[model samples]
Target: MFKYIKNDLPASIVVFFVALPLCLGIALASGAPLFSGLIAGIVGGIMVGALSGSQIGVSGPAAGLAAIVLAAIATLGYENFLVAVVLGGAIQLLFGILRLGIIGYYFPSSVIKGMLTGIGIIIILKQIPHFFGYDPDPEGDFAFFQVDGKNTFSEILETVNNISPGATLIALIGLGILLLWSNVLSKKGKFFQLVQGPLVAVVIGILFYVFTKNNETLAISADHLVNVPVPEDASSFLAQFSFPNFAAITNPAVWLTAFTIALVASLETLLCVEATDKLDPEKRVTPTNRELLAQGTGNIVSGLIGGIPITQVIVRSSANIQSGGKTKASAIIHGFFLLISVMLIPRLLNMIPLSVLAAILFIVGYKLAKPKLFKTMYQLGWKQFLPFITTVLVIVFKDLLWGIGIGLAVGIAVILIKSYQNSHFLHIEGEDVDDGKIKMTLAEEVTFFNKGAILKELDKLPENSYLELDVTKTRYLDNDIIEILEDFSTKAKNKNINIKLISERGIVENPPSYIEFFKLRPKTSV
Candidate 1:
């Protein structure tokens, strides 16, 4: 890992810049203290990254959990919510021990794509107000219906009446720098490659804020700037850490919230693990169980220190990978940066404009939900496109998990429809064959849904006809299907239909019942 320090160290800086605002933004969205987000970021980087076996996946406070966190904090008091976070971590540890990590693999790809696109659109929409210097709502709030009772579109309209000229200018400038740095400067030399665009935008934002302080028209307000909590002294800094109320452990509501956090955090972590593996240059597979263990530990520590919930977030992890991160060391390093910066130069961070951070997120959002992605999904046909678009629209109007659930439902319906249609095919070998000499070929996998079609086909066979039932290509023949074929065989005999059953095990010539002849079992393994 040390050998790759040259690559990892610089990559860590980029991730640090990307994660800093996100940590604060998500906290704001969650209705938690801004410091809590920083604490989660620190723990995710230092604690989780240290324990995790992943080469490049970075963990932190997640946007996906913002709605849950917000609702939980409101339902349970803030102190009680901390207890839930700690218990949630313990539950995650149990999940890893039970080897339930494989459950993450069950989510369909269409739903996942829809999730990614939905989040991207949310990010873009949420940041528009910040980008324009309208800071009535806090950064990192990604919900369609906000805590202030305004929807995403309504907020954007409100921003028009109260746009900050200073913020708008700096945001435009920061976006220009980001675009140039990524598209032009980065390709020019190693210097540009090593220097991330977000950092440049932030530095310029700070300078612009400092120089324009006396000019009211060009001056961004304190509300439109990064607001890191600054402690007056070392003791005051130490006092910022919050501990959970142990008394809340007995509260049933607390337990319910904890379970919700555990379930959501674990899912988000697993999905991020899959996405990170895809982004890894070496394609190293991170142990999902180990990842859960690591994340559990991080969340426990974060909760103890009054931090928001942590998960392996795709945005920061993808940024690290894109910035050429070599190992988990980059993640660890970024954590330390969060710790040290908040402790030492939080005042400087406070000077950075919110608009600049908004610009950076705009690029991240654009990357996640590109126009090409929509076109590509559409070209793949409705089976994929329907779920993808549905996820996007639902997430845009509702929340993350709801969008995912709706997409998954659509995706499953498509699969069932396709299965029913493609269950089997009937073929007559000879040209002059309407004499019920039919060959019925089963699909590779016949489920209960296919039973009706199979039954329909068998019943249509005329009397005294030669029927051949083929299962040679099938790997799994469901019990329902097996029962149908077995019952049909008995009925066929009464009709004087000569039934020939063919399978990989050999052929049977209407000698016995279908169940007894095939040695049917409750479940068939492929």
Candidate 2:
């Protein structure tokens, strides 16, 4: 794990910076205590990172679950909600035990790509307001419809009217420094590479705030800066932690909330696992089942100590990857950073500007949704491109899960259309205009999806035609199709058509019982 400490250390710092505000923001959005977000971030990073199989993925309090968490807390109370979180973790453990991680693998590649791109675009759009210092909404709110009354575009327009000169200036300078460090200085030597651009940008942002504290036009405000909770003393700090009410475990509502969190967090984690693996330069595959176990354990720990639900978040994971993270150590170290920073130097952290972080995320977003990718997807043809674009657009318009769900629906529809077109192949042998002798070959792995196409071909056969039905290449034919063939046989008799069935077992002339014939054969020969 320490093999790449040089890389991991710097990447961890970058991830630490990215995860901090998100932790606070998600907590605020969820209507949980501010300290609870940090607890979740700390637990997610250290515990989940230690247990997870992913090399680059980062776990933390997620924005996606904020709405659910908010509603759960309101309905069940914070202590009871903590119980649900703990129970949710237990359920996630069960999911891992069941090896349900395979669910991550089932999402189509196009949809995954779309998800990444869509999220990228959202990050860029969402950050624009913060970049200009109009941060009415909490950080890490990725939904199109924000917790703030305004939507994405409305917020951007709001930024234009309410721009903070001080914040905007520092943001521009921070963005410039990042561009220079990444494009120019980093390539010049190893030292530049060791010190990440984001860390540099953040340091400058802090210094800018400190130096211009009294300057009217150039001073950034507390509202436009990082807000880590400041503890007066050890006893007050300890007071921040809240314990779950175990007595509420028997409540049906608590169980429902638990199930909801488990299902949603698991899904988001699985999706992030898929996206993070794709973003990994080394292309390492994360064990999804192991990730579930790790997440479950992390959530359990987080809930016991008063924290929001956790998941493997794509934003932090992508930030880690883009910052050159090489191991789980990066994630683990980021957790420590969150823990240590909150405990020791929260005052210093409070000086860092939100715009600087937004600038960093801008780069992250641009990388994910590069224009060249759009052209590349289009070149792959609509079969691949449609789902990719659909995922991107829907994700931009809706939330992550909704976009994925809608994109998956579109992808399935495309598959069905292709299946209908390719279900069978017909050839008229020894063609003599109207002689009507034809051979129909069924596709491999025929399913109910192909029923319409097969029935259409059968209906097109001319009167007195000799029809050859080929199933030699087919495997696992659907029963619905067998019924279609059985029904076609009766129609064939009335139409004076001679039908022959071909299979690996033997050729049957006008088989009276297609169902019985299939049943007698070995399963492999179907």
Candidate 3:
């Protein structure tokens, strides 16, 4: 891990810049103490990164969980919510130990893509308000309808009325710097590469804030600036850490909240792990079970020290990967940066404008929801496209879980519809002949879904027909399908349809019982 420091160090600086506002933003969105986000970021970086099997995946306070955390905190109180976070971590650990990691693989690729795209749209919409310095809703709130009673689009209109020229200017500059760095300067030399676009944007934002302090028309208000908790003294800094209330351990509400957090956080983490692995240039696979354990432990530690719940966040993970991170060291280093910055330079960080961060996030969002992705999914056909679009739309209109649920439902429906359509094929051989020869070829895997088709075709067969039941190419025959064939054999006698079972075991003529005949297990060529 240390060997990659040359690459990891620069990447870590980029991730640190990316994670800083997000940590505070998510905490602010959750209605938790501002410092709680920093704590989670630190633990996610140092502890989780150290333990995780992923080389590129980064864990931190997740925006996806902010809504849940917000409600949970309100319902259980801050201290009690910490208890829930701890228990949630424990539950995640249990999930890992039980080897339930494979569950992540069950999500359809379309649904997963939809998730990333939906989150991308959310990021763009949520940050738009901040880009113009609207501060009624917190920085990281991404719901379609906000806590302030305004929807996503309405807030944009409101932002126009409430725009701070200072913030808008800074945001424009930040975006320009980012675009230039990515598109031009970074390609010129090592010096330009070493100077990350986000860091430069943040520095310029800080300088702009300082220079315009006395200007009434261009001064950014406190509401539009990064709000790290500034400690005046050592004692006050230490007082920021809030411990979980052990007495709440006996509360059933605490346990319920814990399970909810564990379930949601683990799911979000697993999904992010999948996305990050795919994004990796080397295509390295992260151990999902181990990731769960790492996250669980991170949450436990984070809660013990007054932090929000942590998960493998896609925003930070994507930023890390895109910034050329080659190892987990970048993640760890970013955590240390969070720790040192908050402890040593909170005042300096507080001077950075939120608009700059919003500008950076905008770029990230665009990359995730690139227009090309839509065309690619559409070209894949509706079987993939429907679920992908549904997930994206639902996520934009509703919440993350709801979007995923509806998307998964649509995906499953597509699968079932295909299964019904392709269950079997009935070819009436030698039509218009005195003796009809019907050939029924079973699909590769004949399940209960094919029973209706097979039954209907059997009923349509003319009297004294010669029917050939072909299973030679089938690798699996469901018991229900076998029963259907068995029952059909008994009914075939009435139609005077002579049945021949053609399979890998050769043919059986007028089989007394389909099950009995199959039990013979005669070996034949494919």
Candidate 4:
């Protein structure tokens, strides 16, 4: 794991930056205390990252759970919610023990793609308000919209109207610097490549803020600073910790919330695992069960200590990959940084502006949903492209899980259609006509879908033609398919064509009609 430190260090830095605002934003969205998000981020990185088997997976507070968190909080008091989070962690741990990580493997690939695309769209949309400096919530609102009757579109317009001239200008400069650093500077030399674009932009943004503090010359304002919750004293900082309400364990609401967290967090973790696998440069696979156990442990600990639930987050994990994070150490180190930075350097931390952070996230978001990504997936083939495309659109229009659900449904439908239309003919290959004899091979499975295709192939046989249906490799044949073959046998006889069913499961030896041909009478019918 340490062998890749050179890359991991850089990647960790980028992921840390990316996670900061998201941690805070998600907390705000969830209507939870601001500190909860940081706690989750720290736990996700350090606790989850430590126990995780995934080399490249970075865990953090998930935006997908924000809505649920908000609703759960509203339904159950915060103290009760904390209890749920702990139980949720336990549930996830149970899932791991049960070896349910294989569930991720069964989720159709198309659904996964849709999930990523959907999250990308949501990120762009949600952050637009932050980027434009139109914060409708009191620097802590993390819900879909402000409680003050402002919606997403209204907030977008508000950003335009209440746009902090200073923030807009600073963000643009930061974005420009980030773009140039990534696109141009990074390529110019190793020196530039080693220095991450977000780091450079952040530095410049801070400097710009300082220089223009009172110039009356900049559009950005001091109020736009990164407003993480900082305690007035050391003891007060520690006081932020909320112990679990043990009495709440008996509450059904608490259990419901915990179950919700477990399922959602587990799903997000699985998605992150798959995504990380796709993004791994070494193509190393992580043990999904281990990931669940790790995440479950993290959530449990975090909840006990008053932190939000977490999962393997794509944004941070992706940033970690891009930044050259070599091992989980970078992720672990970032968690330490999160803890230490909040505990020690909060005065300086408060100086970092949300707009600046928004600029950094914008870059991360762009990289994830780049046009090239779409084009490349398209070129991979329809089998891949169909699900991927649907996933992207579903994710864009809806939230992560919903998008994935849609993609999964679509993917399953495609499989069903293919299965329904499956056949030994369209799938047949190496056909050769020798002395009026034709030979072809069938697939491993012939389901009801293949009936039509198979029938077409049989119907096309020329008069007095000799045909061989190769099913030697076949394992399972549906009754619907068997009926198709039986019908075709009669047609074959009428057309004066010879038919053959080559399979280990063949019913007849010789001197058999279509009915007697494919049906091997059940042995010892009792």
Give the C-alpha miss distance for residue 37 in model 3, angstroms: 1.2
Candidate 4 wrong stretches, greater than 4 Å: 137-154, 217-219, 376-386, 423-526
Q: What is the number of residue pairs that collide in model 4?
A: 21
- lDDT-wise, the better of 1 and 4 is 1
Model 3: per-residue Cα lDDT over 254-303, one tens digit each: 99999999999999898888778667776565778999999999999999
* C-alpha RMSD for every candidate: 13.5, 14.0, 14.2, 13.2
Q: For residues 63-146, could you state the per-residue lDDT of candidate 2 as single tens digits?
A: 889989999999999999999999999999999999898787556667888999998999999889889989888887788987
Q: Considering lDDT, which of the candidate structures 1 and 3 is the better prediction for this target?
A: 3
Candidate 1, pairs of clashing residues? none
- Stretches of candidate 3 exceeding 4 Å from the true structure: 423-526
lDDT of each candidate versus the true structure: 0.83, 0.88, 0.84, 0.75
Candidate no. 2 TM-score = 0.81
User: Tens digits of per-residue lDDT for model 1 on 303-421?
Assistant: 98899999998888878887789999999999999999999999998998889988988888888888998997786568778888998899899988789788878877876775775
The lDDT ranking, best first, is 2, 3, 1, 4
Evaluated with lDDT, which candidate comes out highest? 2
- Cα deviation of 515, candidate 3, in Å: 42
Between candidates 2 and 4, the one scoring higher on lDDT is 2
